[model samples]
Target: MSERQKPVLRVAIVGAGPAGIYAADLLLKAERPFQVSIDLFEQLPAPYGLVRYGVAPDHPRIKGIVNALRDVLDGGNIRFFGNVRFGTDITLDDLKRHYNAVIFTTGAIRDAELDIPGIELLGSFGASQFVSWYDGHPDVPRDWPLDHTSAAVIGNGNVALDVARMLAKHAEDLLPTEVPANVYDRLVASPITDVHIFGRRGPIQVRFTPLELRELGELRDVDIILDDADFGVDESDERSIATSKQLLVINRILTEWRSRETGRASRRIHLHFYSRPAEILGSDRVTGLRVERTAPDGEGGAHGTGEFREFPVDAVYRAVGYFGSPLDGVPFDDRRGVIPNRAGRAIDDEDERVHGVYASGWIKRGPVGLIGATKSDAMETVQALLGDQSEWWSPSEPDTDAIPRMLEARGIRYTTVQGWHRLDAHERALGEAQQRERVKVVPREEMVEISDPPATAQPT
Candidate 1:
């Protein structure tokens, strides 16, 4: 941090997700003679996108990154501009007009569509939506229905397992967590007993981790039904594989299931392999789904065996993955399903650097990997932004704290970290009062209402 070393560059980072936060940290660490200031913007009033809204509630240790990131925000060099949205309130021109460079780290905000016939039915929803709903997303429906004897999650990834885990959790188990109070109440009310997770590929290709896979056995009263036929592994996979982590994990769970015969729970959580969802069958609402059986191609893939099976289910969740949104200023590639960039450098249609523009995280790489991956992804973008310091940070106007006024004018209510602290305290108090962990606010209105003061408190 020498005078000659401190580089004076003002950077605007869109989306306060891990990628954006990491990029801001890198810019500050550069410590060039020029001042490196980062203005981080988030569409939501709160920061920490997926870390707050995506990760499963039981995995609080994994979300410790939020506190680590809170340190980055408290560094004073990074100004948080929450409740402000890109592609709406302001355009890329407005940001480039003020800051030295703009980094778009807005992660894939939307989930991939299943595009099946009955997908649009009422009971069918994506796993992302379910996760967001239970995690207390302001945009999602508060009073959702899952009143059924059985549910089916259509995917074999970790996300699908998370959905099943949430559904299977004894109401008493979730009572100790930070899950929204209303979501817990609704989940407790759900009569669901069976949760079947389907995979087009065999267990060897399943994407869930060994620890997460083991968590399936911890459920109370939930019978983990398995078929020996589905456990068949390809012979070629044995030699071509580096390690048998996936098989070992699956076998461990299978072994545990076999050892225990009688004392398990009355509910069930079944893991089905080589079963592809061919169609969703429901009446005015979803009643069940049609599944097609498949056989291994011996090359670590599966081919439909032309046999079909149907299961009666009240709800269905597709947990495939997520994709990026098209920002007004950024060059998006539909083929790649992300913003067009060269090693985090935002590139134009003609394959040239779009000056003063960059991208990182899921929007740059397409939704994959854990929170650790965003650090490297963001470092690349920050390095590129540091390359050209002169093009940015020449302020045409003095700084104005417009966030408060803009929110007032647009009728957009928000929650400051202090306000969030207040809500947090209120929830914790409520949870303690009820002898539970913490009751979370389910709807946006309830959250905003708790964050803001009464109308009488405002100055006339």
Candidate 2:
């Protein structure tokens, strides 16, 4: 308590995902006058949010990003609180008691609605749910009904391709990655033969990154089937492709895929462009997918051409997009599925900034970007926190130990960064026994037990 010492800028960031982690890192490194103290709160026993539960495990290239995130969490400058639900385990008033400000980084996890008939069928599913299931998310169901012989994936993004790839990929090929034992077993038992990915626009208008698009053509024992009509690009399409390197690469890859023979492979993925979902055809479960053929309107989008086609798909997955859920005590914009915010500073219904409250990542701006974009996105929110000093919460008890004691008093057995290491070691040990890189722990109770072992339990 010296007069010369600067006051600590205590911040509590909800959701220890890439966005929240990035915000903490930037705040710690920011050229500010005062020292920064951060506490990261996560809902899962694990961290990494979407990266841990939303990414396809088969893609190892994305795992490298975790190293950077790990560096931040392990830096010892931030407190890591895992397995703590924000609203139930802790609340806004609870956070206000321990920190000067709070930042919500709870990114989108729900699937954007696709308004079409029969979408509520038993066999139709949102791609986010499937992604969660396969990624070993603690909350989703472990068993997936891979009973379908043919399936349809609706969307033009990388997620659509991921759904198609997972459906058609051989489970034997996934042994090297961290696919959960339960998911691996289910995939090994799937009878899926063909998976069709539908896009409303042509190849040039697709939202897929070139790398994800190229991976489709690389699956072993799986042939990519495409129709010549889907690739018939007009002058405008050609110009659009030429203007963007991404489109050119996608065009080249699709051109190569178009020339390939299909029946030679044991499994197949069909790419259908200029097709919009008219209905998910089924009674209790999906039996088919009816799509309306669309044509370019010279405005970069497509319009229905009164032509329709049906594919005999037993399951349908909509990878339309991810949407954010409303937080318990935050101003939310239901239309956009994000917290009402202006430049990362959370706003109220009157559009006035809510002092001491902020949002970042998909919760602030919808789910649209990749992990790299999250860094810059978080910096904006961090700047808002650093730049503004007015109305910051004057916590009565800013002690770091107080919040943990509160959780303990509430009988919440939350996980810590050290606990994460233990759980991680356990998964790696499991993978080692199986001669793989890693095996994820799926069930919530098991993950919690593995990460935060009971006090009387022997050392792991």
| Each prediction's TM-score versus the true structure | 0.90, 0.97
Judged by lDDT against the true structure, how good is candidate 2? 0.89
Worst lDDT 10-window in candidate 2: 451-460
* 414 Cα displacement, candidate 1 (Å): 5.2
TM-score of 2: 0.97
Error of 2 at 357 (Å): 0.6
**How many Å off is the CA of 401 in candidate 1?**
4.6
lDDT of prediction 1: 0.78
Write one digit per residue (lDDT tens) for candidate 1, span 371-425: 7788888888777777766554455532435434544576655555555566667
Task: Supply candidate 1's per-residue lDDT for 406.
Answer: 49
